[model samples]
Target: MELIGQGMEGAVYDLGDGRVRKIWFDRRPDDVRPLKAFLDELPPLPFRTPRIHEITADADGQAVSEEDLLTGTALQESGVAEEQALDAFVAVVEALRATVAGPASKALPVLNQPFWREDLSWGEALAALVRRRAAESRHHFRRDVPDFDNLLETLTTRLATIEPDRLSVVHGDICQPNLLMDGPRTAAVLDWGFYSTAGDNTFDAALAAGFFDMYGPDAQRLDNLLLDRFERLGHDRQRMYLYRAAYAITTATIYDADAGDGHYVWCVGNLNRLPR
Candidate 1:
């Protein structure tokens, strides 16, 4: 076996049998159910995603799986044009929609989790992250903490008045690196670890925007285009934009701190650029 990739929870290896193995370590308990659900649901989709052959859990409860995925370059490395990239992105969204809309999309009785929809209030969601970050900060004793409380207060106050009646299943982390492309037009999304059953799709869109802004030039244009697309889908563009900005800030703060930087410079940088 040879190491192919690694992340916070697990490492993936090529097993030299047209298959790959993913072994989990130090993963959250909350992750097990969703990952199992995702794996069970994935093979039925009429798209090009990895096929899980088997699931093996050790006595310690780590996950190991043999799977097959198309071997190719990452989409970001391909440098596809914006239009093509957008089309691919749309395709991914549509595919996910179909999968979740299928009969099998019903919430698992064991998990008792509903499909991601408009049920979660923006304030509630933002507050959860803030609380988590606060706890994390105290545990780590890191200095230069970002003003998470103030940021959360502002976001909560703003979102309290807006009622969200629309919702959808979200690919919680839709950054470019998770996307694989065979060419400019066809692509596949990998890494379902962060997939959520209750999240604003706008949050996902904003995350994509943040990914672009972090890596490319004229990223604001791309962000605007994404927001425009959401608006056309009948979403509240302004509110979603604000929520997205808040989500970005919160994410930066949380991840930066977890990675040992108490001050979330990246998130603050994006937050400062939010339209007044």
Candidate 2:
């Protein structure tokens, strides 16, 4: 077996003959089963998404599954000019908006359950989740804020103010590594574990845009792209800030097994910058 990729939940390896095996490590395959189904329910995207073929246990006692292997260049390793990759990434987000167009938010499965937050309305539940995560890893993280609990209250209160009149599928993580591209086009959007049920589309946009600007290709170009898309979507700068903070905190806590990761530190620093 040739190792190709690894993430928080598991490691992926090539099983030969157009098949790839994913062996779960830290996270259980059963926990993310609903998440994968959520991805399949979305409307056809502009890129290929592999369908799961079989699920079984690896010899090491981890849940394993075989799925179709994508042939395109993983965008992170594409080695193209930054501008080319940046444009392709933004275009994919636009296509993703069209892809997840569907019926009522309440109709979706993993999205419909409201596990993202208690109410999952604007982002009150999301803010709470972040705060809970922050508390869980408080021992690990060096607190940057003077009053962390107050920030949580502020996050929840301000997040509740925005009522999304409409909901769209939110790809929980939309960045270069999750993309498989063929030239300037996104050939596939891989990694479906973080797919959301429904939320303000702009919230999704902000999270992706912030991610690109912070750690992805063409950060400078994406700054304007981020601002323009948010403005066009009628999501104010303040809303983007709120979402970014929540996202940062969430990422920080989730990755706290190692306090030395630069991205994890970046996430914590951004979460600290949020105001009460």
Candidate 3:
């Protein structure tokens, strides 16, 4: 097997059997149960999700899975036309929405793990993250306000009051790189490691909006496309936009903490778009 990609939580390997092995980092016995539960519940959802062939738990309780690797190129590397990318993104989102309505969908827990149910609304979740960041910053650097303080405060104030009644199972992380496109449509949604059941569909849309803002020249086009789809689905455009801004900030903060300057650059791009 050859290592193809790696991240904070897991590593992907080209397993030579026309498949990929995604092995999670060493985990405690307690963590295995939820992961196993997630893997077991993945196949029944009604969307373009990867099919897991097998799941194996090592003696030390770490989990690994071999699954059908998406044969098509990732959207980031596809060199697809902007209009086509937008269409594919919309199709995938619709498919995911349908999946959330399926009876088996609720088996998988919300993406943020143990604290999932507590923050059922997107705004609540963002507020919790902002509060956690503030506390962490205070503990690490006393007195003065941190760079993220203002951004977090503004986002929390704006989003905290917005009601999040639109619920769906979201792909938690919906960036371009994780989406695979074949021909002109999304073939499969790879990487279910961050899948969740509690977030609103807007959470996924926000992720898509943030990605287009980061990579595409016609950033507003992607935003419009997503909002149009949400409207067709009967979602409020204003709320979706709010979640998009919040999601962008939340995403950038995670990357900035884990990775470094590259993520900071991404953070600034998203931060600049927050509604003044």
Candidate 4:
């Protein structure tokens, strides 16, 4: 096997055949079974999603799973025209929005783990998540943000105003790396489960547009382009900004508990730049 991809959660390896093995850093077989079950039952969409062939344990008892390798260059690295990339990105979100999740998917875990409550609306749950994450990690960001509390309060207030949404599969992380492209079309969507949930489809739309470009030198301009595209397509621009801010705050300390990583820095910068 050859190491192909790595991230905060796990490492992925090519299994020599037409499959890959993901060695989870902190998950167990049972931990991901629900995700596998849910993906297995998904109705066909315009693009391919993950398929977990099986989950097992390595010698160290860490979860190891084999899955079909849906091959494509990541969308951002595929050299497709910017317009084409943006179109594919928005198309994927729209596809998920149009397709409804069945009852079996209700068991899929959301962004905040066991803290996720079923009764809360999508926006309400996100607001609660902001509170939970802030309680644990605010100290690391307060000095830099100065008005961290005020910003957080405002974010939660805006979150509370989101209208109730239809239940659809929300792919919480739809950034460049997760989107694979063959030519100008989306070949597959990879790496599910960190924030996969059964919730409002608009949440996916908002986050997908923001995640399109978050760190490049032209990031702000590209972000504006995607936001404009979504707005023209009827997505509320303010709500997209609100969701982006909430995502930054809630995930600032997720990959680095002490806010010491580049992603944390990105989150802090995003907070500082929020609509003032």
Candidate 5:
């Protein structure tokens, strides 16, 4: 088996003959449950996502999942121009959101870890995640972001007071890496690893913007471009910070490899630095 990709929950490997196995390290079934459930509910997207069929075990006894390997170049590794890819990403998100538009709970029946494993209000779920991450990453947060403690305090306090008024189906993690560029204007979405049952739909766009801003060679230009585009869509540009902050904290711990990769560092740098 050749290692194709790795994320917080598990590592995916190519098993030849167009089959891939994603084996979880923590051996947690919660991650796999949501992924399978969410994909089943999506109304025929324009792009391809893996079709998971079975869960078994590897030779060493790790919990392994089998999926039919869909074909396309991953956007993050494709060396495509940022502007072009970003536009495709936004298009895919909009299309997917439209596909699943419905009453909140019926929209996307996916569960996220630590926060939304149950039917909780948005405020309750987000606050749970924030508090958990703040405690776990106190040292990393303090060292990286300016005013980590203050940011933590402020977010934890503010997040608890709010509830989502309108909810749409959301692909909770739509960062650049989850997209695959199949054509100039088309993209294949992969990795429905986490979907929110009740979520703020606008936050998904902001999450993609964060990925673009962090990975771009020039930060300011991309930031301004995204701000203009999202603002035009009537997204509350200011509230993006809150969404971005919650996203950063929950995902920073994934794929850290005990701090080898700089992902956690990158996430921390953007944790609470709202646009000026």
Candidate 6:
């Protein structure tokens, strides 16, 4: 086996066949079963998506799953022109938006627990989730974002205004790493279940726009460009900003619970800079 990728959730290894294995860092076999079932039932789309073949547990009790190998390089590493890549990114998001959320989509658990409630509206669940995350990492935000409380209040207000939405399949993490490209087209989308939910489709649009290049020198400019594109596609700009802020606050400590990574810095910057 050859190591191919790693993230907070797991490490992926090429099995030297037509398959790859993912050794989950923080999940159980049973925990992944619902996600597998959800993916297995998804309607066909323009590009490929993950398909788990088998699941087991490691000696340490981490879940491990084998999946069909997706063929292509990550979009960021594929040398595709920035313009073309952005178009493909938008295309995939649009495809997902076209898929109306269903029972299976809603039944799959989101990344965080306790905050997610089937009876609650998407906006309410999202607000509760942000509150949960903020409570967990308020110390870091208080230091870096002097207006942490105000920002949280602003986000909560914005979320409450969202009301119930027409549910769509929101990929939740449509970043460069998770998107594989064959030339200018998306070959496959990988790594579901981080923040995956069947909530507002604009949430995916907003997050994907910023996630295109979070750490690059041109990150902010590129983010604005993608946001403009999405706005032109009929997504509301304010709603998008609300979703982006929600993502920043909710995921600030996701990878590093103490909020020490560059993602934390980026999230702080967003918290301070985004209009409240």
- The candidate with the higher TM-score, 2 or 5, is 2
Candidate 6 Cα deviation (angstroms), residue 110:
2.6
Leading candidate by TM-score: 6
Taking every candidate in turn, the Cα RMSD to the unseen true structure, in Å, is 5.0, 3.8, 4.4, 2.0, 3.8, 1.7
Superior by lDDT: candidate 5 or candidate 6: 6
- Where model 1 places Cα greater than 4 Å from the true spot, the runs are 28-33, 42-46, 50-53, 58-61, 94-127, 134-150, 158-167, 258-263
Q: Whose TM-score is higher: candidate 3's or candidate 5's? A: 5
lDDT of every predicted structure (CA atoms)? 0.57, 0.66, 0.61, 0.81, 0.68, 0.85
lDDT (0-100) at residue 39 of candidate 6?
A: 83
lDDT of 6 by residue, 1-276 (tens): 999888878899999999999999889999888789878867788988999999999999889999999988899899999999899879988998888776767777666564446678889888888888789888988898977898899788779667745888888999998888888889999888777767888889998988999888999899999999999998999888888888888888888997789999988888777775
lDDT of residue 138 for candidate 2: 63
Residue range with the least summed lDDT across 10 consecutive positions in model 6: 109-118
lDDT of 5 by residue, 60-106 (tens): 66677888887677776777786787787678757655654334334
lDDT of each residue in 163-198, candidate 2, tens digit only: 776666667677778888787778887776454556
Clashing pairs in 5: none
After superposing candidate 3 on the true structure, give the runs of residues whose Cα lies further than 4 Å from its correct spot.
2-4, 16-18, 26-33, 42-47, 57-61, 101-113, 118-123, 137-154, 213-235, 258-260
Please write out the lDDT profile of model 4 over residues 92-129, one tens digit for every residue. Answer: 88888887877556777665364346587667877887
Q: What's the ranking of the predictions by lDDT, best on top?
A: 6, 4, 5, 2, 3, 1
lDDT-superior candidate, 4 or 6: 6
Residue pairs in collision within model 4: none
- True-structure Cα RMSD, model 1: 5.0
Count clashing residue pairs per candidate: 1, 1, 0, 0, 0, 0
Quick one: how many clashes does candidate 4 have?
0
